[model samples]
Target: MKRLMLDGPGALRWEDAPEPTLDAPAQALVRPVALATCDLDPAVLQGRFPLAGPYPFGHEGVAEVVAVGEEVRTVRPGDKVVVPFQISCGACGPCLRGNTGNCAAHPLMSSFGLGPLGGLDWGGLWADLTRIPHADAMLVKLPDGIDPITVASASDNIPDAYRAVAPQLAAYPGAEVLVLGGPAAPSIGLYAAGLAVALGASRAVYLDTDPERLSIAAKLGAEPIEGAPAERVGRFPIVVEAAGGSKALIAAVRATANDGWCTSVSVQAKDTALPMLEMYSRCCTFHTGRAHARPSIPHVLDLVATGRFDPSPVTTRTVPLADSIDALLEGPVKLVATN
Candidate 1:
């Protein structure tokens, strides 16, 4: 099989690799039917973060269960499933509390496509085949009649977006939401905005320099704000920073309402100064952590199945596995590579 490997910063290559098989009772062997890049991949490739090279290069994909171990009964061979970015064992304490991202039974770090995790740098789904651990806990079967391309984002982006707004929904019902960033065509932001609306948000504002992305946000019922940091303006009770930039981060904090909440999905390597005095005075609550993808995947998928959310519009292009690298390097929105 062929897989995308990161040789160094701004460097991506497709190389031959061994096929993956079930390595444990809770594992399953899956053949990717479709895969897409996360919003953070390009930034990591550009060395904007502390990511090291020669690692697996993708973390989002939809696949078919080709085989499963004895302990895996939730899904069977031929079932289509969404694979989350984080690998976790279902029985752990963290997992029981719906925190699958920090599952304790797995390796201390088991993230896909990154070496920071202490486990086998589990390569991403930008390949013909991949291994899924704790199969019953990690894979979510796609709903009947839903396009595989549409649900690809559910593997990571959609769930991550949902997590960004989950903590704020109860406190600020119908509160305004401001999303910062325009990656994978403002995918993370757009998904979150849609979720917020579904959850009864009164308004969802999206800020991005890209006109195309802003247009998409508008179509999804969000008010689009365009321009640079100086030109962009808005104040919201819940702000989500997905832009992955220092200026965007600062703007999100500055624009948040008093006693508001700001959720950050962007990963920045550089140190950023915060308005501590301002935040203190305003009584703002800021939360930053990895999205517990596995646990959130099911609910997001159900929403998609019920027609409450549609991620298909975010896909700008779809290519074959052979063109995965090119798809990763250039795209304004979601790009899927199919086998």
Candidate 2:
């Protein structure tokens, strides 16, 4: 099998690797039929994250079940499915609570791809064949109506955006959402704006300099604002900071309305000074963390199947496996690399 191996930052190659076998009774072997990048994948490619080289290089996509474990009943051979990035057992305490990212049975940061985070070693999804453990919990059987290439992000980014804003809308009807976004955040920020509008937000505004992102947001019914995040003072009741820059994070915090909630999807390592005083004064609630993608999959998928939430606009290009390594290593949000 040929897999995308990351030798170093911005360095990728097609390497021959043994096909993954079903390693456990609950595991399954699936062939990647449609591959794409998650929000953090681009950052990993550019070396922004502390990832050592030589590992499978992607974690977003839908797969065709080549084989299934004896215990796996939800899906069968030849079934196409979406695998969430996080490695979690649905039977765990945290997963039962809809926080699959923090499974109590695994290491704190247990996940597929992103090599060796805290000593957990699951390979990437950019391969011909890959193993999926806890198949029933880890895989979402792709519905007949959804396109695997387009909904490739359903494994991570699309669902993350759904998780970020769906609850907020449910909690506060007609809420206003402000997405402190940039081109680096990928389609996630745009996905959030689209979800907010579809889920009944009073107003959804996307702030960014990228014409492409802004155009997508506008097409999705969001009011696109062209400016720097730091220059904005519009206090939104619900704010999402998908831009990984420190300035954008700070501005996101600063723009939260009193008693409002700000959810930051950016995964940054360095510390940046935030407007703690202002946030404290306003009694604002701020949250920064990894998304719990599995639980939200059903709702998001329902929306996708019904055409209520379209993932097509998120993808800029679709390439074949032979030419996918470069696309995986660089440029454009939501590049769909199909088998």
Task: For candidate 2, write residues 110-193 as lDDT tens digits.
Answer: 777777663436778888888888899889888887878878888888888987799888988899999977755768888999
- Report lDDT per candidate: 0.78, 0.84
Cα lDDT tens digits, model 1, 21-104, are 777998898888888877767666666555776776777888999999998889999999999888888888998998888889
- Lowest lDDT sum, 10 consecutive residues, model 2, at 112-121
With a 3 Å backbone cut-off (N, CA, C), the pairs that clash in candidate 1 are 181-243
- Candidate 1 TM-score over all chains jointly: 0.92
**Among all candidates shown, the one with the greatest TM-score:** 2
Against the true structure, what is each candidate's TM-score? Answer: 0.92, 0.95
Pairs with backbone N, CA or C atoms under 3 Å apart (clashes), candidate 2: none
Q: Please report the candidate that would top lDDT against the real structure.
A: 2
Q: Which ten residues in a row have the lowest lDDT in candidate 1?
A: 113-122
